[model samples]
Target: MKLRIVHQTVYRYDRPVRNLVQSLRLTPSVFEGQRAHDWVIEVGGGIRGPGFRDGAGDWIEGWTVRGPTEEVTVAVTGRIETRDTAGVLRGHRELIHPLAYGRGTAATRADAALRELAASVTEAADSLDLAHRLSAAVSDAIAYAPGRTEFHTTAAEALAQGEGVCQDHAHALISVARLRGLPARYVSGYLQAAAAGEAHEAAHAWAEIHVDRLGWVGFDPANRCCPDERYVRLGSGLDASDAAPIRGIAAGQGAETLDVAVNVEDVERLQTQSQSQTQS
Candidate 1:
């Protein structure tokens, strides 16, 4: 599957500001299930930018704007290719070293519950399918609910209460993989839909396991399945904080507000001029 994405972000101010700086992870990442064919970003205001790579291998852009500015617009357009490979990822072959994704970040710490879960799950890994089975077990153990916590919430807390969102799911999975000496990374992306017939809103996130021969393979614990053509992977990192699509701080004292709008639809249908596109 191929997709074209448009993401727009705006900052509104009650009073004029002086300067601004931001970190952007908007650029799509190339991993096992997805490929970035072509991509570009456009800012419609007075903004200066530079590109850099972060510790997690995510493409980062430092953007800054100067003074008394009312608004700034950042638009990203791109084409991505997707494939399904449940067998390509060989998690059993790769043993975890304290190099890349194994190290837990300041925000994402493995609490007692998470450590206990990992210890119990991989203690008797007699088969190569332990990761998958453990992932499914986590999905079964927790329920996906919103308004339960903020973005900075911890995995141990979620697992203790048996509840969380995609971030918690990914965090738990990453910690478990690390405990078992397998490499795992956090993935943030836009899910086309929740389930086969369910409605999806906004953005979605998941996790990827590093297999020696297969490289990185993704598993959507929220959906209880491996990522396929339906998923359009955007960026990946050590945890959600490193992989967040957008984050920044603005100068001011009054309350600041943010508004974001995103539309991820199949451009093939719209371009092919199908009946559905015509109707839409």
Candidate 2:
């Protein structure tokens, strides 16, 4: 599949900010399942710095805006060719040890409730089965509903509420996976809709667990399935905040408001041609 994506983020300040610096993890991951093409990242009136890959195989770039400015915009445009890898992450180079992800973050701390959730799924035949069961349990526990939670909402909080967005689902899954002694991490990315012309939310998020023989395998509780060609993985971390596409700090006390828009569309003609050639 060939996918075209456009993502835009605007931050508005009530008063002029003295300065701003941001770290971006917006580039798509290089793996067996996908490859990036014609990728570009632009920041309005901001200076771009050196680009490098982190230990987790995520592309990182720095941007600085020196100005008493009221607003700043970050835009990304790209095309990616993807294949169905059944959510198995292969051929991706990263230096971080799998055990490192087992460490808990504040957002993914498993309380008594989360511990019980993990305990309930302990009857699985193997680690892979347990991971699948855990994903289903999360989807059953937390219904996918937007505007019901905030960015800072923790996994425990979302579980108690029984509703949250994809980020909450990812956090909840990570919390339980860690409780079960499995290594898990959060993934940030873009998700093309299953059907044509179907609208989707802003950016998408999911979870990945390291399996014994399969290495890293992705699971999306919000979607109740493993990531396929429709998913474009950008980065991974212990939790959502850690894997955020954009993280920044602005000098001054002005309040900030954020607006985000993301569009993921399939290149129908290209896909058709690729499929025909494969069949021939």
Candidate 3:
């Protein structure tokens, strides 16, 4: 499947900021499951700086806006050809050891509840089955409720509340998986909605666990399935904040507000429509 994506983020400040600097991990991952084409990242009125691939094989680029300005916009446009790999990450080069992901983050730290949840899935046949069971446990533990949690909500908190969005689901799964001694990390990406009017966050997240021989495999407990061709993997980190597509800071202390819009379209569907129109 081929997909076209447009993601835009706008920042508005109550007062003008002195300057702004950003680190972007917005580029799509290069793996057997997906290939990117004509990808572009633009920052309005900003200068692009050095870029490098990190140990985790994620591309990071720096941008700066020498602003005494009140507004900044970051826009991304791209097309990707994707395959269904059954959520297995294949042919992706990375230097980080799987054990590194075992380290916990503030957002993914396991609490007693998480530990118990992880222990509840004790009857798996193998590590892969165990990982799947852990994800299912998390799915049953948390309900997907947007606006019920904030960015800083931890895995423990979300589990206790029993409701949150994709990020919370990913975090909670990561926490419990770690408790089960599985090396897990957070994955940030885009998901094409299942139906035209389906309620799903285009900007989505999931968890990946390392199996002994399989490397890393993704699991999205929020959706109760493995990621497929409809998903576009951008980057991974210990948790959401670390895996954020864009992380930036303004020099001045001006209050800031933000708005984000994301759209993912099936290029094949659009082309089919065009061909049908021509025949008509």
Candidate 4:
């Protein structure tokens, strides 16, 4: 299957920014079962009119503009070809290694609750059926709720509270997997539209656990299923902070207003016959 994606983020400040810098992870990743024909990060760099990536790879760019600049807009656009793998990640060449992910900062070590959860998820890795079963168990154990968490919340906090969005779901699953020594990475991406008549947000978060036999396979405890063609991977890292679509600092002081808009429209797209074979 092939997909075209465009994601945009805008910042509007009541006061003009003297300077700013940002790191972006907005480009869709070519991994595990995806390829990019043309992926570019188009930026309105305040004073600079436009900037873009010439090809596919980790990309970074920024700007320092004079004050009196009240708005900054960033957009990522590209055409990508993706397919569903046979529930396995193939090939030795990969950029999604665990050690390579994240803010490159030391993460606070996992606690006892997370350690126990990891044991539970890894205990049933004898077969695909067992893995799926474990995933379902997580789903049954947690509830999805918004506004129940903040940026500093931990897996145990969310689990004890029994509610969270995909971010919490990811932290819970990652904590469990990491405790078992399985290399898991946080995936930030946009899913194809949700089920018919469903009111859904435009983005989703999940985890990919690396197994001895099956390279890297995705598990979405929130939805109780493996990632299919509907999933378009953007970036992966140790946690959500590392793979956030945008992270930055603004020089302005007054309360700033920010708005983000994301649309990943692939309506009427059906899975391809060979989706089961393609794997990055």
Instruction: Give the alpha-carbon lDDT of every model.
Output: 0.72, 0.93, 0.92, 0.64
**Candidate 1 weakest ten by summed lDDT:** 87-96
TM-score for candidate 4, please give it.
Answer: 0.77
Task: Provide the lDDT at 256 for model 3.
Answer: 87
lDDT of 2 at 249: 94
Q: Considering TM-score, which of the candidate structures 2 and 4 is the better prediction for this target?
A: 2
Q: Residues 93-198, candidate 2, lDDT per residue (tens digit)? A: 9999999999999999988998888888867888899999999999999999999999999999999999999999999999999888899999999998732536
Give the alpha carbon lDDT tens digit for every residue of 108-132 in model 4.
2466665655466545645454556
Reference-based TM-score of each model: 0.82, 0.94, 0.97, 0.77
lDDT of 4: 0.64
Clashes of each: 3, 0, 0, 2
Candidates 1 and 4 compared: the better one by TM-score is 1
Candidate 2 clashes between residue pairs 3 or more apart in a chain or in different chains: none
Question: How high a TM-score does candidate 3 get?
Answer: 0.97
Please write out the lDDT profile of model 1 over residues 117-164, one tens digit for every residue: 777774544323666866876797678888786688877777878888
Error of 1 at 218 (Å): 1.4
Off by over 4 Å in 3: 194-201, 277-280
